[model samples]
Target: MNKVKVLLAEDEASLGMIVKESLESRDFVVFHAENGEKAYEVYQTEKPDILVLDVMMPLKDGFTLAKEIRLENKHIPIIFLTAKSQTSDVLEGFNNGGNDYLKKPFSMEELIVRIKSLLNRIELKPNIENIKIGNYTFNFTKQTLIHSSEIVQLTHREAELLFYLVEKKNEVLDRTFILNKLWGNDDFFNARSMDVFISKLRKKLRNDDTIQIMNVRGFGYKLLC
Candidate 1:
């Protein structure tokens, strides 16, 4: 499985590092941003699986940044880290679609549990849609890919690769995870085979201008539209 990347956005340098280190110890890859503007940049570039934000920050506020992130990724979890603790404020956090909110001075253990709980909830959400890629439609349940009146069959491995790629669409997928999950090892031969499969899928998807599979050298591939 891919490690979850979290963005820790807080203006306080010391607190930001503390939260970031704490999450890092839990096996989460964290990006720390001191201000709201910088935080939003990380949100765009890092595309973290979870966002831990402070309510007060320079340039942009937590509520505003959360609102913008909601527009892009409705499913990504957002958690506010703030000292402010009023009924109305908590209500406002939910109003902006936060999955969880952690009050400042929170224990590391509490944060970890909250993060795990939210991630569990995210995983439980149904994954049923037959994804649409330009003229092609991927029937996930059927494990079939169809394009412009023609249907293409996939071996089990190919199907799984497609599933992973689609699941991380618009985000970088680590090569190591894909190799371990599908090939059972991150050997050079397996990597070559994976590349071949990616090429084949690209050919099949050539008609779709809305989707592209890009290699993010040294990191992995990013499927984007």
Candidate 2:
């Protein structure tokens, strides 16, 4: 089996070293970069399987690096490590192409778990095929929603949320259940993030009048077709 390659960029020397060692111990082939520029350089040359980036760096912060990387690869998972815990900060990370965010002073175990979860999410399942939702054709593998002549690209999280809704179409999916299943938590922050993704999904699926993602009062959401 090929070892998973990780490109980790963190300016804090001690923290970077600790993370590098911990991941390496778990058999991950990690390439550590102390600055964002070096991280980008390594990314282009090494083509790591995943990216773990720190928000504050000497040059080209994590968000900027993520944007540049996204231009080249739309599906590579990015995990941002930042000290900032504001809602806006978390949303910015997602907008800038992050698949997951971990605040600073995080435990190594939690980091490892998140990395595994992301890898699991992106791993291809041979059985998954395109699904028809109302008039839109959803290609799970490509993370795209296609209508007559329109194609809407979906982010990783959006695609997952859509998949879950489609799988349980017309059934009430509890908010806590969805949050715990997708995000591994039912915390306030994750709940808010889920809401944002839900709203985005509603907009994407709005062209078809027959398809609606209805919010059940004080319960959760349901995809009614």
Candidate 3:
């Protein structure tokens, strides 16, 4: 079996070395870079399975580097390592196409756990057992969401949101919680983007009379059946 390839970009040499050693001990082939530019260079050459990036870096910021990666492959999982803890900072990471994020001064164990969780989700295989959602039949394992005879191919984000909503059917998803978990932060712009996605999802399921997606004012969204 091939070891999981991880690309680490951190200007802090000592911290980067420690993280690389830890991951390598766990059977991950580690590629290290001291700056964002070198990180991208390594990425282009290695095409690592996941990326660990520092927010502030030399040559180019992590955010800019991540945007470049997103343009090449949107689904590639990215975990931001940042010293900044503001809500806006976290939201910006997600808005640019990050999956899992970690605050700096984090434990190596925690990082490993998060990385494993992200990979599990990225490689998620659903058990399609006739899940009924109003008038639709969802076959998640097949990656096909069906409404009557029409099939909609969902992007990973769309599928993830739908899965979470369906799991909490008839319940309201709290705005802050949803944003933090799904989007990494609850900023004004991300909140707006979430609304847009909600609208798109509602439109996708509009054919079902029994299904409804309601925005709870000042709170979050409720998916009802």
Best candidate (score: TM-score): 2
CA lDDT, every prediction? 0.77, 0.89, 0.80
Cα TM-score of candidate 1:
0.56
lDDT of 1 by residue, 1-225 (tens): 899898888999998888888888889999999989999998888878888889989999898899888767666777888788765675466556565577778898878776776677567545445687667788754546888788885533455577788889889989999876554457775577678778877876777788899999998888886
lDDT of 3 by residue, 192-216 (tens): 7578668778888888888998888
RMSD of each: 16.0, 2.2, 5.6
- Give the candidates in order of lDDT, highest first: 2, 3, 1
Estimate the TM-score of every prediction.
0.56, 0.89, 0.68
Error of 3 at 157 (Å): 5.6
Off by over 4 Å in 2: 124-130, 217-219
lDDT of 1 at 61: 88
Clash count of each predicted structure: 0, 0, 0
TM-score of 2: 0.89
**Candidate with the greatest lDDT versus the true structure:** 2
Predicted candidate 2 versus true structure: per-residue lDDT over 114-178, tens digit per residue: 88888887774333556999999998767789999999988767877888898889999888888
Off by over 4 Å in 1: 127-225
